[model samples]
Target: MKLLAVDDARARILAEIAALPAETVPLARSIGRVLAEDVAAVRDQPPFAASAMDGWAVRSADCPGSLKIVGESAAGHGFEGRVGAGEAVRIFTGAAVPAGCDAIVIQEDATREGETVLVPAIAAGRSVRPAAGDFKAGAVLLTRGTRIDPWRLSLAASAGRAEVSVGGRARVALLSTGEEIVQAPATPGPFQIYDSGSPALAEMVESWGGTAVRARPVRDELDAVIAALRDADAELIVTVGGASVGDHDLVRAAAVVLGLSLRVESVNVRPGKPTFFGVLGDGRRLLGLPGNPASAFVCAEMFLKPILSAYQGAPTAPATMPARLAEALPANGSREHWMRAKLTYADGGVSVRPYRDQDSSLISVFAASDALMRRMPGAQAAEAGTVVEVLPLSRA
Candidate 1:
């Protein structure tokens, strides 16, 4: 099988997936969910010309003169009568400005004398929040494909939306395969180690807005792996380990027996060259990851994150930012490399420094890393001050 570039593999995987169907959920529960339809304002914000400060509503022409206090307008209650010439209405903050009033004179700028007030000159529309100041009725405030956050939820609430239509969360099944691996809390034999990848991967899937369904670790037998794959109930199946051509790697053979049509056989990237993607006979997608902890982590960021984003109708591109290199780096080899690194923020700029040890099995190294510094294939050596691209790990 020919090795595929990272971008080509990602593109092919995304092409086989589509956004999940839309479902209506309460506005308060829609945070972190992608919008499936546009949300329009039901009524004008404020809905009327209102006062912005605790003051007196008066005609601009009548200000700077003594005037009789006609009535008071508190929030949720308006002064019914209009503000005639030489008269004023006591208005509190957020109160609707009385009819025929063109401006508000703050209480600080006025003196009250037993039903009469003396105010300073004020301009029309001063201290008055015009109707529809924030938004007008029927105006679209939230568009489709937008992920709802606290601020967006506030906006939707202000638009009078009690419920919103959002994309359904994608259900992902996680399967781990290995004969020498045992689940935690159980004593392992001398040659067996506890499984670690699936637990972390499940949390990653949830953090990326997908529902993770974890299956028990399966032994390397072909039938066991096949049965596990067949029993997974999800739109996407993520298999950890058993992707290489070793004798114990039975995931590929079992998938073939289940009618796997390969889309990506392998990737040409350091530490994750054995990563593969395909579609099963039942029309579900499968992503095979390397068993090494660091390799699996890096490939999840490189491919699985984007796949999950596509499934939720969110932007499918990795968000990479530019930063200066804090230390010198040697020229890259024939394959692309994503070096785990730490990030520093100082002097209004970001700097990245790659760790000296980048072994695939070092879970400690990955735990300490907050960013991945990218180096293209055959790239020249970089100086300390050279600018480079980096992808931020959300957990950092």
Candidate 2:
């Protein structure tokens, strides 16, 4: 295939991705997972009319006068008798108000005189919480595609849900193939270098809530590379390096030999032009990233993360904001430029400045950056203070 534009490639990948099936998980283990089904409240919150504080439950008309005290009502124990005329029931916070009582007189305003309690200025509905005030039974508490967080989890528990149906996590396999690539734990020879992109991709997979099933490092051999590609456990296979058209780039050659057709051969994006996307016969996804450290980072943020999120039924997209340019930028060339930059909090909004060393292999510069200023293809130059769209790398 010819080179694909960034948006076109992304749209194709999203259109082809298959969302995973759902599974039941206990509420305790559901945080950060996406809901596959709508969750309904099992029962009403504050199941009955209850008192909001330590006070007396009495008829709304019995305020500013003395009333005979009846049985007491504490949390988990409610008074059974009705609050008749000139009568009050001693109640504590969370205690259900007795029948015929529409209000609670705070204890601070009431003085006890043996069996009679003296009440002062009390308004109707004061210090009283009605049943279902927060949420009613059978109400939808959580909708499908909602990502569960601490606050949402608390709300689910309050809605009386012990278990929920959530989308299954995608199992991803990380593969790194090259003649000079050596495992990080082993010392590299003078001509060899440690394979850093594979491990970083594995961590990124885990951060996006996908399980990294395998991280295999292979030399530039067709058969061995084909064998590693057949790992059956992974729903998505991500290969770092061995994708460019150079003679030593053997991943695409082996994939073609194994009958995995390439869906996207290249993309018009900086630090990621050599990326390749394909699919295996068994319906698993195949994404080949450039071997350069920064290139791999950019492609993962642009492609891999979105595919994984689609599998999880995530409801939201990455955050973007308008940021002022701290310095002038030259007009972009044919490819989209994702300039790695630092964010400066300004009085009006954030400002961004690209790092000087933007080489695809510069890990130090990538580490120093917090955001990616997105410059479109062939865009015109802009002076400092120009507002541009920025995607924060931290959120990615």
Whose lDDT is greatest here? 1
Tell me how far candidate 1 lies from the true structure as C-alpha RMSD in angstroms: 3.0
Backbone clashes in candidate 1 total: 0
List candidate 1 segments past 4 Å from native. Answer: 54-58, 65-81, 86-93, 104-118, 179-196, 345-348, 364-368
Cα-based TM-score, every candidate:
0.86, 0.81
- For each candidate in the order shown, give its overall lDDT on alpha carbons: 0.92, 0.86
Worst lDDT window (10 residues) for model 2? Answer: 312-321
| Model 2, position 109: C-alpha lDDT score | 84
TM-score of candidate 1 against the unseen true structure: 0.86
In candidate 2, position 205 carries an lDDT of 84
How accurate locally is residue 169 in candidate 2, as Cα lDDT from 0 to 100?
87
Query: In candidate 2, which residue ranges exceed 4 Å CA deviation?
Result: 49-120, 127-129, 179-195, 207-209, 313-319, 342-356, 364-370, 393-396
